[model samples]
Every structure is written in structure tokens, then in C-alpha cells.
Target: MCQEQKGFTLWFTGLPCSGKSAVADRVAEILRSRNLKVERLDGDIVRKSLCRDLGFSREHRNENIRRVTFVAKLLTRNGVAVLTSFISPYREIRDEARREIGEFIEVYVKCPLEVCMARDVKGMYQKAIKGEIKEFTGISDPYEEPLQPELVLETDKETLEESAQKVINCLKKLGYLDHNF
Candidate 1:
């Protein structure tokens, strides 16, 4: 008999260059390898398309996440695994997303600001620090840490594989994935 897979949203939130995208990508690969349907909604890619008209201000940022949340909700309820990687710096907005998407799993990609800045190849942190980029999370703006995230991956300390495995383990424990996977 064929087993039906349930869908869930893996929401990865963190500061810039904190390995949110990388870990989410790895998890998506693992999920897909298990023959699960997966869709990845990343900040950079979405901003170039769905959120191109948006800016970095707080209002724009919230609107950007609202739009993503809407898409995720639809995908999740339709039995498609959705992985999203965005800074999503506000706790209220993340909570709102959780409410909107029933199967939301918030993964706090916890990395030190200094470490994230060090990992910045695009010099986004540098630009933000120099006031060239305003309203940048962890620099000019703020990133409110999750009060009770479903998972926390400290990219500053954990290897990519380890962090990805943690997410997989969480999904299995939460019954989002088959334990055999």
C-alpha cells in the first residue's frame, strides 16, 4: 500500500548570512530524496520576484512576510512541504505566520551577529553598518529572537550537516516525517 505524506512548513528565520538558506536547502534535498514534494521559498529569490516592489522598511518587511505566509499556507494545506528562508526579524510577524499556516515549524537559525557579519560575502553587514543600507536586521534594525522556536540551529557552532539533521529529526519527532526516513 502507498503511504500518503502530510505537508508541513519549515520556516527558517535568522540574520543575514546565518546559514538559513543553506540549511533549508539541505533539508529540502533530504525531503525530496525521500520522495516528498518540496517547495523552497527563499528571501533572495522571492524578493527578485514576488516581493520585488517591497523595500526594507518595517512595513515593507511585514508585507513581504505576509505575502510569503499566504503562499506557504496554500502549499502546506495542499499537502506540499514548503521550506522558507527569510530573516523574518519580528516575533509578531513570525507568530502571525504560525497562526496562518497550521503546520508551521519555526527554525531559529541562531548565529552570533559577529559571526554572521564574518560570513557575509556580499558585504551586506558592512553596508548596513556604514549606514548605506538602512533597516538591516542585526545592524541598523533589530532581529527579535524567537521566544519558543520549534528548533534552534546555532550555525556558528554546528556543522551544516548537523544543523540539517536536527531539523530532520525534529520533523520526524513531530510526526511530520516518517521515522523510517
Candidate 2:
């Protein structure tokens, strides 16, 4: 039998501009400061590299989720805290991730659509509104959120630090962190 590594995945799922990436970045940094190996894989970054050819089509989105989930499993098996930020948009994909990786925590970064559009840090919402972008979740497409996630973070009102601290606390409580130093 293969030995299990002391690694886990904290998956962040939310609409664009919902603060998933920013909060994941903070949580990963906090975990690393305590000596835990960390790997953050954001959807935008992945699309720019491994999934550069992918489009906004639903089929492509599903494939993107699968690819990211596969990489998350690999990283977790190798003893890295894999933090994945993506607007996964499907319960089926999240379920697959749970089955593939033994330790997967799905965090729903809940933000109102209006709030997300206002933030639009990447200007994706603007492009979608201008009809320049297609199959945009919450605009031209849909984002079916997780039915029951481990944590539902309301980022519209919460500070990124607060959101990150909640995730860190959960990890510490779950023994994913040896101790929150």
C-alpha cells in the first residue's frame, strides 16, 4: 500500500472578482510562513499556461476543471498544500476532486453578482458586458455553485485578511497545519 502524505487541498470556487485568488494567495502565504509547502494554482494563471488554448465554452470549462483537479491530486500526493482557485461552476467536477484527492476542502467564496461585477479586477465582467467575451459565467453562462461546501466565505463584505484567517483557522482545526504559529 502507498503511504499517505501529510498534504491537503483547499479548493476555492467562486465567480470572477469574488476575491478567490486574493484570499487564496493570503492563505497560502500564511501556511508557508509556518513551514508548510504550498502550491497555488489559479484558473487564470493556468489558462495562460497549461490551458492557453481553452475557450469559454462549457466543454472547455469542464476540461479545465478536470485538468486542474488532476494536477491538484498530484501535488497533494507529493506533500504540497494545493490551493486551487477557480470558478469551477459544477458540482460534478467538485465531487470528482473530492474522490480523486482524499483531503479536499471546498470553499465557496460567495459574493453577490453585482459586487463581483463592480470589482471586476481583471475587467472580465466589462468585456462580457460589452459582448466581447462569450460564455462568461454569471453573464453569458452559468456558474452552478457547490451544493454544500466545507466553507462559504462572503467576500463582498469580508476583508481578504479575514477570509484568509478563516481558511487558516479551518486548516489548523483540521490538523492540516501542525500548529498555527
Candidate 3:
């Protein structure tokens, strides 16, 4: 197999409004600008396709993570950087993806629930409050944070540009990046 065949998957895990997807979007854009092949596999888009009718129960959440992990594995094996923004919410689920994907990099979009709710660009928190959505994350459900992520980002304290730069630096440090690659 070609050495370059081992591409990477940067999995962004956080609460619903915790800027996980936002940071992933910026990171993907920057990587593409550098001529690096990258694809973003976001939860909302994936769920709407493969898991549309799935509820917010823990089982459903785990299944969602599994589906994303499968896709990420395929993309990474095909030499494309895969950025997954999903509220994986469970350490076991995230760990399963790590073990399965092998080249996975976990980046925790760490932000307090209050901070995430305040940044609720989609008003999910407000709707959850009115019982419009049941078992919403960081509210009715629990989010098991990563114990030792390869990269941990405090999204609440940094701009999206800064956050993307942080991940880029991490990849460089890991020798997964080179100016001529």
C-alpha cells in the first residue's frame, strides 16, 4: 500500500451548540485552501440521511456515531481528511470509532453548557426548554467528555480561525503534514 494512503480523521465531539460543527467547517475550509483533500461529515447532515427517523435515545446516538465512524474510515482510507462533527456524547462510542478508524484524532470542543446555550445559533436550547425536543444533549442527556483527547479545543475562548490553526499545528507535529506533500 502507498504510505500516503493513511489519511486522517479529525473527530470533533461536543454539545449541540458547542461550536463543534462551526470549528470543523473552518478547519475543513483552511485545509482545502492548502490543496489538502478534506471532507466534513456532520451529524445533522448524516442523521438526515442514514439516521433520519432515529430518536434522541442513547441507543440511537450510539448508532449514529457508528455510522459516521464507518464513513470516516472509508474516507480516510481513500486519502481524504475526514472531519466529523458529532455530539458523540459517550466516551465508549468515541473510543469505538478511534479503535475502528485507527488514524482518528479526537478534538474536544470544550465549552460549558451555559456558554453553548448562549451561543445557540439554532435556538435548540430554547426549544428544548419548551419541551419541543426531548432528551436534548447537555440538558436531558449527558455528554461524556473525552479523558485524553489528542487535541482539546476550548472553542468558547477562541475564534474559529485560531481553533483551526490549533488543529493544523497538531497535524504538523504528528508528522502527518509536509510542505511538499
Question: For this target, which candidate reaches the highest lDDT against the unseen true structure?
Answer: 1
* Global Cα RMSD, each model: 0.8, 2.7, 2.0
Q: Compose the digit string of candidate 1's lDDT tens values, residues 1-181.
A: 8876788999999999999999999999998888899999999999999999999999999999999999999999989999999999999999999999999999999999899999886889889888999888988888999999999999989999999999999998999987888
Per-residue C-alpha lDDT of model 2 across residues 1-181, encoded as one tens digit per residue: 9544488999999888898899999998887876778999998799999899888777888889889888999999889999999998878878888999889999999999999999889889999999998888899888888888888899978889899988987887787765634
What stretches of model 1 exceed 4 Å from their correct place?
Answer: none
The CA lDDT at 114 in model 3 is 91
Q: What overall lDDT goes with each candidate model?
A: 0.94, 0.88, 0.88
The TM-scores, one per candidate, come to 0.98, 0.93, 0.94
Off by over 4 Å in 2: 1-5
* Clash pairs for candidate 3: none
lDDT of 3 by residue, 1-181 (tens): 6356349999999888888888899988888887788999998898889889787798988988888889889989899989999989999989999999999899999988899889888899999988898998888888898999999888788888888888888888777777443
Clashes of each: 0, 0, 0
Residue 42 lDDT in model 2? 94
